[model samples]
Target: MHGIEIAVSTVIFALRDDPRNDCTALGMPLVRRVRQPYEGSWALPGGPVRPDEDLTDTARRTLVETTALSPTYLEQLYTFGHVDRASKPVPGPRVISVVYWALVRPEEAERGIEDDNVAWHAADHPPELAFDHATIVDYALWRLRTKMEYSRIAQAFLGETFTLAQLRQVYEVVLQRTLDPANFRRQVESSGGVEPTGEYLVGGRHRPPKLYRHRAASDLADNGPLTRL
Candidate 1:
């Protein structure tokens, strides 16, 4: 009897300019496979987990090797081990995939483009993926949008100091909706998720906007059990 094969994958998201729409969109990098079972198809960056490494380490190493990325916010998203998930014929034990999700700033994400067979695709409209990666991306997106409503996860997409408008844009892009400036400001202040940095963003048409930084991680909304890892 064949033993189960363990694998690791990661969905690393960043806000990037989508030339197709000429707007910034949430996207992640995908690598095109060269071998069969789903050759030439785009999929998340990952590979088989080594026995000597932990799951998280495997996820991190695969991401860096495939896209040269080191995400600022990395957390375990889910484990998928359906009996029929892999395209390979049965009789062999199922393949188990431990999926992780991460967030990185746009500038940092660009560095990943240097890798071969890797390219960024908008998360909301990814191409057909190999295996069940399409479903995995959708689930990762759901977790991201849901987390934005409560936690300061959005901060991972921005620099150390950012204006309220900039922060609001991150939400608008992920949530796919516009927000009232006054209301968003009030809500964020009341939530104490951010604090003024005593700095301001200049060079825009309007008055300079004050910049803010995220509160300490411990003070932010709980990210469930992953925060303790």
Candidate 2:
């Protein structure tokens, strides 16, 4: 009788230029399978879980080995283990995948490997993927968009300090909507989630804009007790 096999996968998002529109958009790296059930199809960066490694470690290792990415914001997303999740013409045992979602700044995203097998693609409009990866990608994107509304998760896409306009762009790109500059600035200021860094960004053609940083009291995401993790 076939037994269950455990694996780990990651959905890593980054803000980059959308090749389709030439505007900032969410993208993720995918690896093409070289063999077996879904050979030659794009899939998430992942591999089997090692006996000595925990789920998160396996997720991180696979990311580095497959795409050369090591995101700072990594969290357990969800588990997928439907009985038919791995069904195929080729013989294979049942697979239980523990999925993790990660966010990386654009600079970090550039570290990913781009080649015949690994490449970045628009996360919102991924190509035909192997297995149920399309479903998994949709779920991860939904979670990120939902959390972007009420959490400071947007900061994950930016650096240490940024102007209100820069921060708003992150929101616009991820949320896929334009926000009024004046209204957005007012709302962000009133939220108390960010504080002025008392520094101005120089070298811009227009007047320098004040830089702001995420407040220490506010965590990236409200993961309850897991906030410390």
Candidate 3:
């Protein structure tokens, strides 16, 4: 009889600003595994699949189980299966894993997860991760960066009805570079991703700033896209 093992893992990404880029660039979260074969080591959230469960079902279930976080955007990223990955266990077959990329809203992130030990690190400077997780994260981020440049995915980083400045922050963080405000605003207008509310808020230390909400359809479509992060 042939036997196979399946597991689901997640690469959860959030927007974070770092001073290295002059308060630019964002990062993701990587949790430490408490199990053997990599016990007390850092890795993405993952768990073995139970019988009769689908690949994504395992990923979603594992996310809540480990992080107490329900990902707002969840999509299958990739599948990894290589020789010697499970050579330790005698008679054990190849272990195949399906990794997912998920994005969490800023508020949801601030609310945070139940696991206090989970540490959120900058994506550009990730720690030594267990197994092949570093490679996994790299791929996921590349996909996000590529998609963001052309698509309006960067809007996911902001709240409803945000100012041009807020939208620019998302790009700066993800790209790890400063965006020309004029060029950014021009591009945003052409994309039709946001519309001005003709309303301004005056709570900051400076003058009131204009606000705009990301189009509703764009938000919904984000939930539908199969992404790695």
Best by lDDT: 2
lDDT, model 1, position 143: 92
Ranking by TM-score: 2, 1, 3
User: What TM-score fits each model?
Assistant: 0.91, 0.93, 0.84
Model with the higher lDDT, candidate 2 or 3: 2
Choose the strongest candidate by TM-score. 2
Q: Please identify model 1 stretches exceeding 4 Å from their true place.
A: 88-93, 204-206, 217-229
lDDT, each prediction: 0.86, 0.88, 0.77
* Model 1 agreement with the true structure over 1-229: per-residue lDDT tens digits: 5677999999989998767778889988999999766788899999999989999899999988988888888888999999888845323447899999988887797655786799998899998898889999999999999988767889889878899988999999999999999999999889887899887786765778898998865333356775576
lDDT of model 2, residue 42: 94
- Candidate 2 yields a Cα-based lDDT of 0.88
Q: RMSDs, each prediction?
A: 2.2, 1.9, 3.7
Q: Report the lDDT tens digits of candidate 3 across residue range 36-90.
A: 6666768888889888888888988988887777766777888888765654533
